[model samples]
Target: MKPLDEQQAAARSWFESLRDRICAAFEGIEREAGSDAGFAYTPWDRVDPSGEPGGGGVRGVMKGKVFEKVGVNVSTVGGTFEGEFAKSIHGAGDDPRFFATGISLVAHMANPHVPAVHMNTRFLCTTKRWFGGGADLNPPIPYDTDTADFHVTMQAACDAHDPAHYPRFKQWADDYFYIPHRQVHRGVGGIFYDHLSDDWARDFAFTRDVGEAFLRIYPALVRRRMGQAFDDADRARQLEWRGRYAEFNLVYDRGTLFGLKTGGNIDAILMSLPPLATWS
Candidate 1:
């Protein structure tokens, strides 16, 4: 693996900082809900089969009155991709060496009305370097207002970079996040993008704005709906929808596949799974 350079170091620092800010925001919400729950971090390391230091990261999780369960993971791993996997990854064909740094989050709300969400942004250094990630909202009972607010914030982030970003990425999210077995869209999608290349500076700036947009909007959405009342029916719907979420992540989510393939921590890789979900 190539020695970590200044760019990789800078990206890794930003990811960790984002993780801290997000965890603090969530802990604050927990406090507001009268629960003392705060994120408990567990650090893990990865070693190549050759026993070389591959890199490592920390997993942060919190369970509380408002956030039933949430996981924020930051990992920077470097190693050669295994035999067949090298053919599939960017920049690994010539030499299987690679490095990746990113922040991933999954929040499952206790209140059904407060939609569950997923967000992740990453920079991967293979023979190629690029940025990828976006956020999506999964509501048991969809609300026009909430969906609109989420998309509007996402659009502003895209518009800040390029006029074409929102429309392109919005369609990309709808297409990428679809569940073929169930033949349904995963959620009222936000945006999902990947393989964004052409310029590192511009792409990195856009990726940072994407995270900023999520931080700015998601908590406000949580505060608005967390207080809303929900009955048994709503709870059941949330569970059933969560089943769909689990199926999609296990079957189709690229991030899940990437994590598992890269020898990432199993718990952190599967952290997107809701604590409790129903098939029916």
Candidate 2:
């Protein structure tokens, strides 16, 4: 494997730091709930199609009283995009070589009222360099207050960077997260933006703000509803909703496809899956 450039090293460092903070926050929540659960971290390596070293990542997961299952992963990978896949990635058609570093997180709460959530932010470099990712809330039993808060926090993050960003990215998330066949959305929409290569410094700052916004808001939301009472019917509804989430990740998620195409670690790539889900 080649040594990381300055930008790549900085991004990888920030991502790993974010992962540590998030895991600590979650463990604190577990302690509050009278459970001592903590995240278990597993490091995995990747091998490119050429059988050369490709960078890898650590997968951190925890199952606890509040958070039924949650995975926080940080990876820094560099390799060539495989055949047809090269044509599909931005800026990679002509030069398939690429470098990517990012953090991805998904949490499915034990209590149905406590929403499940997904958040990811990444910096990728091919012929073009860009940053992309977003966060969304998924609840089987939706709440107006929770939805409003989540959107407002995300909007603030966007507004700090560019006033135009909130509306544009929010709609992008709405359109991107939809399950076309089911005619339903995976979750209440957040902001999703891609191919943001205009200015590297500005774009990277915005990406960092997105991560900070999620760190501030999501834990508060979790603590708010984690103690709420839920019944079997509620659990059933959560499971059914998770089925739709699964479908979208398996079929429509670009991140999933990128991981597979890049020869990323299978278990780390799939850490987004809920610990348990039901189709019906």
Candidate 3:
């Protein structure tokens, strides 16, 4: 078990704040759609005995709602790391001083018209240095307008900090979210960057402020489309898209890869999966 650095502490606080806002926003969405939506948060024990070394975030589930088949989770899991993917991505130095912490989130929406979304942010530190986390989206459906709006919201957040950020990072999302074998992107893409070296402090401040942007943008998008109504055909397409989502995560997502490599608890890592998934 190890103690958190200043950046990790800030990231943890941001993740917690996002967790609360996410729960409330979706609850309101379900209500507005005239559907029942509720979530349960289960706190899990940290991996290390000291409790400071690691811990799981809130796990939530919502079912039989007007616009969601199952809204299974929104969470932040933080801890130190090791193993193949972590070593490959974050580097494996002999120094035990390096510590990693991050938050990951995913939501499954009911309406075929709406897209599923995910966001993650974190900070990793060694005695001498640290870096930041950026977020991205994976929508199930391909609504051009919705996709544009989603990216635009993300871009706006980045633009406020640095104009150059929106384009480069958006392109990063576009590239990062793709399923290479399938030859299709996960969604329109938001933004994904990690271990940033340039303007690290600016990136952190930007990351923290963007949390509010997420709280504002995502629910508005969901509310607009969740109850818009879709036919059986649309529902089928949604399922098909979700199948791809599952494949990408199970097959290629970096987070999933690291979790498995670290001997992380299976349930916590797979908690990102939708409860009532369908494949065709």
Best prediction by TM-score: 2
RMSD of each: 1.0, 0.8, 3.1
lDDT of 2 by residue, 80-142 (tens): 888888999999999999999999999998999998999999999999899999998888889
How much is the lDDT of residue 82 in candidate 2? 86
The global C-alpha lDDT for each of the candidates, from Candidate 1 onward, is 0.92, 0.92, 0.66
Which segments of model 3 are wrong by more than 4 Å? 48-53, 64-86, 96-98, 127-132, 276-279
TM-score of each: 0.98, 0.99, 0.85
Total clashing residue pairs per candidate?
A: 1, 0, 3
Cα-lDDT of candidate 2: 0.92
**What TM-score does prediction 3 earn?**
0.85
